[model samples]
Target: MQPVQAPVLGPQVDYRSLVVVLLSPLAFALVFASWTIFAVLGVELKRVLLFGEVQFAVLLAMPMLTGALAALPMALLARRVGGRRVMIGSLLLICPLLWAIAYSDVYLEFLLAGAGLGLGAGSLAAGLVYVASLCPRRHAGLALGLYGAGMLGAGLTYFLLPLVSQAYGWPMAPKLFLLPVLLVALLLWIFAEDAPRMPHAPLDSLAEPDGARSESPSWYWLPPPAVCRLALYYSFFYGAFVALALWLPGYLAAQYALPLKQAALWALAFTLPVGIGQIVGGALADRRDFRDLRWWVSACVMVCLFLLSYPDFTMQIHGVHGDIALRFSMPLGGFTALLAVMGMAMGIGKGSLMCLLYRDHGDDMARSGGLALALGGLFAAVLPLMFVLGNEWIGIRTAGFMFLYAALAVCMLLMLWDGARTRSSPLTRHSSQPPSQAD
Candidate 1:
């Protein structure tokens, strides 16, 4: 059997690469923090607007909708003009909208402001493209993972916004975020540099041999099949992460009957682990094959989701003379622990998926990453509405977990089928290619 070759690390590291890695995540964190401002603020908005469950869900979903819509366009523009331009332009455009959200007195106004704020979320695709351009190929996974760890910004919002709102009112939270947004914008303008351009083949030409030519298809066409599959994978891992980050505060308040502040704290417990786990996941992907890492993580998360899907259950048994009662429910502490475990697994899966994309589509990272993020964000936007509908229609508070569990089960089955097909292929016997390459 042929041994797998180790990834080649470039002989020298670029200091500019270090700068991009350090600042990009920090900038992304600030953008994410602003993008997710609605999660915490929506609680206050619900009270102010006197909105019903569905209405509030829509309110929380508005930014995600806009983010999803903008992701692909922003990514394409970044690829053409430069990531720095896209990132800076996006940050600048959202600042006014955030300020408007702070002062919005009515529901429509807040919705409009939120739609504008959605542009902030598009920064993820731009940041991914930008960081990939700067870093060495061997280190792309770790670099993207570190940048992705900026998701901790959501945790920061969960932890800090409630406290600030308590002191200065919820309106002040958006205003406070403006400071960081502006600061990051200035830093990016001063320090950020566009990476040297790498030559790329058309996505359609990827299957052809070296020096082969194919028709250059229209730029606006649908993504390739591999991109769609990766997007589906991302929709479950990162998309679910986005949905839960926004939904958890409300879910905790409703399900566990906790106050807003306490609910935010509990939600933070889940968000922090997911954010930190990305780094570990990325590092693992750099050293090992991402396919194996993703499969193991997905399997573990499926178990946790299965366990979490059960609503508080109670049973009555009739005995010879008397009645016996049985009750089964996960306590709050235990539920939070399970969520933490799931978050860790998701964090790893997110990193591994990004690594896999870079490895397979290195030439078209911008377009592929952008489309994947757009689909994931679209899924994130839709899940909140589903959560509200599930609760109302089924009368089960844990319905959201049930939905997630079913989706993950389907994803796992597809992975298994793909694995089987690979092993059965004639190429598998003769080629020493990595499992990821075979896929």
Candidate 2:
């Protein structure tokens, strides 16, 4: 067979590449919608199965754990074979698994089927690599930002799944997901083109002369410290975003005594901003210093978490004549407004973090982005358990916000420490870029 030709990189925009970039996010949205179906269904399942708080948390977390574990291998496969093929195959494979989930009668059966459906989440790893290959280096931030908007599918599920379940039945929810998954997969198969692969080279030998590195980095290169930092930030921002997406419908219903449909709508107060903020954040990262942007975003999130950390409190005062009582609590509208702001902050952080990852590891984005996402997903998985434990131990619904507050506090402290250290260095003063950029 003849060798595959290199992709032409012209000065003008490549409309073919742009089309692929646009389509990749739409495909991702469908897969993501399917992957997160459990979030909406879990609330109903809790009632049907008579599951306790911890068990419900486990049920919610299972798919995230499985999805995180699958990310690295799926990304490597995308790199080796082709992103388009991996994406199409993943979408096709998850359809039957979703059907199985819909048909599952026992809790154990549902858990097993949900694990299989988790593969749908791995589409992000492949989609990232696929979109990155099509866009120029300068545009990678915007491209990834646009692709990241596929997360809006999580919001879409929040809006639509409850309605679907109400209209058809809980079992029919996953079955509805089947239609879009197949449609997106077929469109991708017909229209999407995989990026051309470069010849094999030693991992360390691919470094650029000025140390900027090419678009395709080696798979075996050790991740820099920045990767871990970004992962932590992402875990709090993107991971927490995922956790809340799963948690919020139930949260609103329990906390405010809202109907399921109303609760889902309230959840959108958080989810919609996160989706739109990513696009705005991506555009900002392209023009501004990502380091500065990330710091500001983290600071804002820290404050929001602080406000959100408060649980309902009541105090009674004894007077000469009688007794007086006072209560302090955030109203639902106030709480939702805080979540909206927090979502925007997370969205900006998500966009900036991806930009940093692509800038530093563009060549190996499949691995690096996948690993980052995996780590973030792990946090998403664990936090739900923490939320349950916090609630059970503390006997307060808002206990989860305390956990988030602590996490964001740690992130803020680390950022400040890193910032102070960087400021003291003369070289860092000259260029505020990450040490990996020096490579």
Candidate 3:
């Protein structure tokens, strides 16, 4: 790779770039909030429709599945047309869909309209490209983190839906988003630029001969292997985050028998920390290599997962004196605390991993970011079903935690192997330098 260089800046550049960074993630947060609308709404939909558990689960997963599939293509479109345009287009696309969802009473109609929320995945990809291009190397992690913290938008739905539905009814809940979505889309159009030459290959690579660069369209869109490695790390953390965000309201409701609105409120414990921790992780990533921090974050999450994986059980012992019985169950307070810690750890993992992505793979930001988001979406989609099946097949409520623990173990082992391989490499040595010194 060509040596990193400092970007030339004008007085106006900083102000403009600042606008892009601030404005873009606001757009992202709104998109993200809208993306998971079904999470809160599904509870009511179930009662009204009288749908089975599996059908409810499918309805929950459909947007994530479609979003995962759409992320890459939308990212590719962003690459050609521009991040600003795609993000604006994505925001606009969501408005009609929200209307469709609010008006629909049928299960099939609501399900399909809900699927349109996947456009937010595209919003994420394109917005990341626009924001990362303007961030200086010294503050890339912090910039990315701030952008990521927009995920707090999910909380808007969590906190808002209960009040909206309670007052106006469930159908009016989705309609509430229509004005804000349009407002954000309009702001993006007025303030955000296309970032004409965002992240792409080095100047040297751009100078390659036409003959040398010739390749199939399929080959051209593929991200490099190094990027895929980073995506693997991100997918697990982000996927779990998304899955739990969707699953938790329901999980809390069923496991504790809490009312749906109350359960949604409680789940803010997990979702809020995840957003805050991303800012923490991204700032740290900007200052140093993330490998060591990644290990610590993973270890913390694993410990929590280990605790969470245990199901309620009773034990009996036969003794000469008498019979002894022991019983154990997870307390709601303790479970919420564990969820908060794990969410923070996962958020840190996500923040740092994304920083690392921009650090190394910004040159192909669209494809690489798309690939990671897509994988995360697929993982999120699979997890709800797994939660359902695990409960049925294994007859353990904590089975979802068990599955996550296993997946995280595999990720950690792979990271360790990769770390050992890179330890002695020149690139690793160079990357260890401080951003200012390295540049």
Global lDDT of model 1: 0.81
Cα error, candidate 3, residue 421 (Å): 3.7
lDDT of each structure? 0.81, 0.79, 0.83
Query: Candidate 2, residues 1-439: lDDT per residue as tens digits?
Result: 2223222231224866776778889887887777677777888888887878888888788878888888877877788788889888989988998889878878888788877877866677888877776777666677788898898888778888888899999988888888888888888888777777744432335465665756354445346676667666676787888888889888889888998888888988887888788878877777765877887888788788888888889999998889999999889999999999999988988988887777666666766788887887898899889889877887878878888888878877888887788679887555545543432
Best by lDDT: 3
lDDT of 2: 0.79
Question: How far in Å is the alpha carbon of 248 misplaced in model 3?
Answer: 0.2
Off by over 4 Å in 1: 1-12, 202-214, 217-221, 427-439
RMSD of each: 3.4, 5.6, 3.3
- Which is better, 2 or 3, measured by lDDT? 3
Better of 2 and 3 by TM-score: 3
Give TM-scores for every candidate, taking all chains together and pairing residue i with residue i.
0.91, 0.89, 0.91
Model 2 misplaced stretches (Cα beyond 4 Å)? 1-12, 199-221, 318-323, 423-439
Per-residue lDDT tens digits for candidate 1, residues 118-217, read: 8886577788888877777777788988999998888779888889999999888888878887888788888888865555553334344666654454
